[model samples]
Target: MINRIHIHLSLLVCTILEIIPMPISFGTYRPDWLLMGLVFWNMFHPQNMNIGIAFLYGLVLDVLLGYTLGMHALAFSLVMYVASIHHLRFKNYSIWQQSGIVGLYTAFHNMVLFWSQHWLNDAFFHLNYFWPIATTMFLWPWCFWLLNRVRRERLRH
Candidate 1:
C-alpha cells in the first residue's frame, strides 16, 4: 500500500513537471518528464505499475496539457508495454546503456505524438520537436538514481 502511494506520488510530481511552463528559449527543449517516470516505474516495478496505469496517467497528462484526449494515453501505454516486456534485460545493462535504450523509447513516444498531431491537427513537422528525446536521454541517469533511492527508502520503511 505504501509502495503504491510512493509510486503514484512520484508520477504525480512528474506529471506536474511536464505541464509547468518554461521560458520560450528552453520550452522547446523541455524533457518528457512524465514519460521518464512512467518508464522508470514500468521497468523497476512492473508488477505494480503496468500498461493500464500508464494509460491512465497518460490520459491525465493529456487532459492537463489540453492535448487530444487519447494521444498521450496511447503513446504511454505502448512505451510501457515495451518497457515491461524487456525490463529484466534492461536491469542488467549499465546505466549509460540503459539511457540509450531509454532514448529509443522516448523517441518512439515522441514519434507517436508527432504523428498523431500531424494527422489529427495537420501540424507541421519541426526539427525542434524532437529535442525532448535528447534531453530525456541525458537526464535518465539522474532520474533513475533519484527514483531508485526513493524506492529503496520506501521499501526500507
Candidate 2:
C-alpha cells in the first residue's frame, strides 16, 4: 500500500513538472518528465504500473495540458506495454545502455504522438518536435537513479 502511494506520488510530481512553464528559448528542450516517470515505474515495478495506469495518467495529462483527449493515452499505453514486457532485459543493462534503449522508447512515444496528431488534427511536422527525445535520453540515467533511490528508501521504511 505504501509502495503504491510512493509510486503514485512520484508520478504526480512528474506530471506537475510536465506542466510547469519554461522560457521559450529553453521550452523546446524540456524533457518529457512524465514519460520518464512512467518508464521508470513500468520498468522496475511492472506489476504496480501497467497499461491501464499509463492510459489514465495520459488522459489526466491530456486534460491538464489541453491536448487532444486520447493522443497521450495511446502513446503512453504502448510505451508502458513495451517497457513492462522487456523490463527484465532492461534491468540487466548498464545505465548508459539503458539510456540508449530509453531513447528509442522515447522516440517511439513521440512518433506515436506525432502520428496521432497528424492524423486527427493535421498537425504540422517540425524538426523541433523531436528535441525531447535527445533530452529525455540525456536525462534518463539521473531520472532512473533518483526514482530508484526513492523506491529503495520507501521500501526500507
Candidate 3:
C-alpha cells in the first residue's frame, strides 16, 4: 500500500543519514536512527518486516560502509526479531511507551555492536560507548511523531 511505501522510504532516509559523515563528537553521539525505523516497521508490519529484510538492510549498510560481512546484518536481525515477536504490544502502546521501549531496543542493539567490535578486534569496553542510548531516547519522541505524521499525510493521498 501507499502507506507502507511511505514508511519504507522514511526508514531508508534514516539509514542514509547514518552513513553520512558528521563531526567527530557527533559521530559518537549519533543516535540509532535505523534501529528506530526498524522498531516502527516491526510494530506496524510484522508480516512485512521479516528477519530476511532486516538482514538485507544491514548487509546493505555493511557493504556501504565496507565494515565486514554480516556484522550489521546479524545485530539488526536480532533486534528486529525481538520487535517482530512482540509487535502487538509495541503497536498498541502509547507513543511514550513505544519510545521508551525503542530507547531500550536501540541501547541493546548498540551493546551488541560494541561486542561485535570487540569480536572483530579485541576492543575494551568504555562507558562512553553507551552514550548514544541517551541520545536516542532524547530524540525518540521527535522521530516517532515525524514518522506518524508522514504515515498520516502520505497514506491519506
TM-score, structure 1 vs. true: 0.97
lDDT of 3 at 123: 82
Residue 69 of candidate 3: its Cα lDDT? 80
- lDDT accuracy of residue 64 in candidate 1: 95
On the 0 to 100 scale, the lDDT of residue 83 in model 3 is 86
Runs with alpha carbons beyond 4 Å of true place in candidate 1: none
lDDT leaderboard ranking: 2, 1, 3
Deviation from native of the Cα of residue 81 in model 3, angstroms:
0.8
Clashing pairs in 2: none
Residue-wise C-alpha lDDT for candidate 1, range 41-145, written one tens digit per residue = 887788999999999999999999899999999999999989999999998999999999999999999889988999999999899977998999999999999
Please count the clashing residue pairs in each candidate, in the order shown. Answer: 0, 0, 0
lDDT per residue for candidate 2 within 1-157, as digits (tens), equals 7779999999999999898988889988889899899988887788888999999999999999899999899999999889888999998999999999989898999999999999998999999988999999999999998999998998899
Sort by TM-score, best first: 1, 2, 3
lDDT of 3 by residue, 8-121 (tens): 798799889888889887888888888888777777677777888889889888898897788889889999888888899788888788778887888778778778889888
